[model samples]
Target: MINGISIYEILTLTTILFFIGVYGFFTRKNLITILMSIELILNASAINFVIINTYLYPENLQGAIFSVFIIAVAAAETALAVAIIINLYKMITSVEVKGTELMKY
Candidate 1:
């Protein structure tokens, strides 16, 4: 047991979260839902890094640093995505994937 939680348990939870994110991204039609799923996936990745670093190698802070970078990137991505979604909504008045198919104009 590392940090009071088993590594196996952490891995299992992360795996489950990753799959849920995948399912959400693929099944949801709304742009906002897809963005939520992407965030979930990013969170799972961040959790995995911190857990592994805390358990396997407590001497260094590389994992934590990478996690921070990932979070920063995610934030930037979210901001840009939301902006694009807003623009698309203004153009078509819908957030559905099908509605974006006409963005060619």
Candidate 2:
């Protein structure tokens, strides 16, 4: 246990966050909402990495390093995704998933 919270409890929270992110990703139509859900999913995984690493290897910082890397990658991914979404929205005037299908040509 860390900070008075058991590993099971922490893992449970991460699981809930992961599922919420997954649900949002599948059900949301707007590009921005989908992007947010992706971020949530990424964040949950990062937290899981940190917590599990800390619990299993109290002396090692591998999990912390990985979480940092994940965050950096996620930021870059978000920047690129937002740019693409913005261009798509400009061309179609809609950010819905169906609207992007018109760009398939």
- How close is every model to the real structure, measured as TM-score? 0.92, 0.91
lDDT of 2 by residue, 6-100 (tens): 88999999999999999999999899999999999999999999999888777888898999999999999999999999898788898899886
RMSD of each: 2.3, 1.9
Stretches of candidate 1 above 4 Å error? Answer: 1-4, 103-105
lDDT of 2 at 29: 87
* Candidate 1 minimal-lDDT segment of 10 residues: 1-10
Residue 50, model 2: lDDT of 95
How would you encode candidate 1's per-residue C-alpha lDDT over 36-102 as one tens digit per residue? 9999999999998998898889999999999999999999999999999999899889999999775
Give residue 37's error in model 1 in angstroms: 0.2
Q: For model 1, which pairs clash?
A: none
